[model samples]
Target: MSRIGKKPVELPSGVEATVSGQTIEVKGPKGTRSFKATDDVTFSVENNAITVTPRGKSKRARQQWGMSRSMVENLVTGVTTGFKKELEINGVGYRATMQGDKVLKLALGYSHDVNFEVPEGVTVTAPKQTEIIVEGIDQQLVGQVAANIREWRAPEPYKGKGIKYKGEYIFRKEGKKK
Candidate 1:
């Protein structure tokens, strides 16, 4: 038996969930999100909890069972507390700021400033010149936006200068001897 699949996802106060056919929708104070499960797995809402069960004793069914449960849990969490990702910029003259309501301007030692257009359902803000915060109801979108920003200037091993996630560690390398 799958340990994660066997556990039911509990709905906290102020959160609501509804099931329709192969789809499940969750509504909370923050927002509403929905997910569609595959035929290999079945989902149900009962007693303020959501449960995922496999349709048959097959490998695919078992795999979908656990994954479906996790998706439902994420939906509940997304609509309730939401998700956030923080990025730290390190380098000389490296900075970030908001160009407009939906654009982020970054200066990472490049010839010209780079403008990143923020997509819908996600918000990017720079509280400090070297710090960036990405917030949204969808966890995947928030993480993807953070990764895209970091890709522009990943931390280097020599000086560890560039953009990185807050609390992320960069292994340092020694320079060549003169």
Candidate 2:
């Protein structure tokens, strides 16, 4: 038996969930999110809780059973408290600034500033010159946005000069002997 699958997801106050066909939708004060399960697993809603059960004892069904339940739980969390990702910039003259809520201007020791356009359903903010915060209801989207920004200048082991996720550790390499 799958431990995660056996546990039902409880809907907190001010939250509602509905299961239709193979899809489950959760609505809360933040927003509404949904997840579609595979045929191997089935979803049911009862008594303010969502349950995911495997169609059969097959390996695939058991796998989907646990994954589908986690997905539904993520949907509930996404629509309630939302998700966030923080990025830190390190290097001489590297900085970030938010131009309203639409654009994020970045200077990573480049000749020209990088103008990152904010996508729909996500908000990017720069609380400090070297700190950036990405917020959104969708966890995947928020993480993707933060990754894309970090890609512009990934931290280098030599000098650690680049953008990286907050609290990320970069292994430093010793310089060549003179």
* Winner by TM-score: 1
Model 1 misplacement above 4 A: none
TM-score of structure candidate 2 = 0.96
Which pairs clash in the backbone of model 2? none
TM-score of each candidate structure, all chains considered together: 0.98, 0.96
Q: Supply the global lDDT for candidate 1.
A: 0.95
Worst 10 residues of 1 by lDDT: 36-45
Write one digit per residue (lDDT tens) for candidate 2, span 80-167.
8999999999999999999988999999988999999999999899989999999988989999999999999999999999999999
- Tell me the lDDT of model 1 at 21: 90
Among the numbered candidates, top lDDT falls to 1
Error of 2 at 84 (Å): 0.8
* Ten-residue region with minimum lDDT total, candidate 2: 17-26
Each candidate: RMSD = 0.7, 1.0
lDDT of 2 at 13: 90
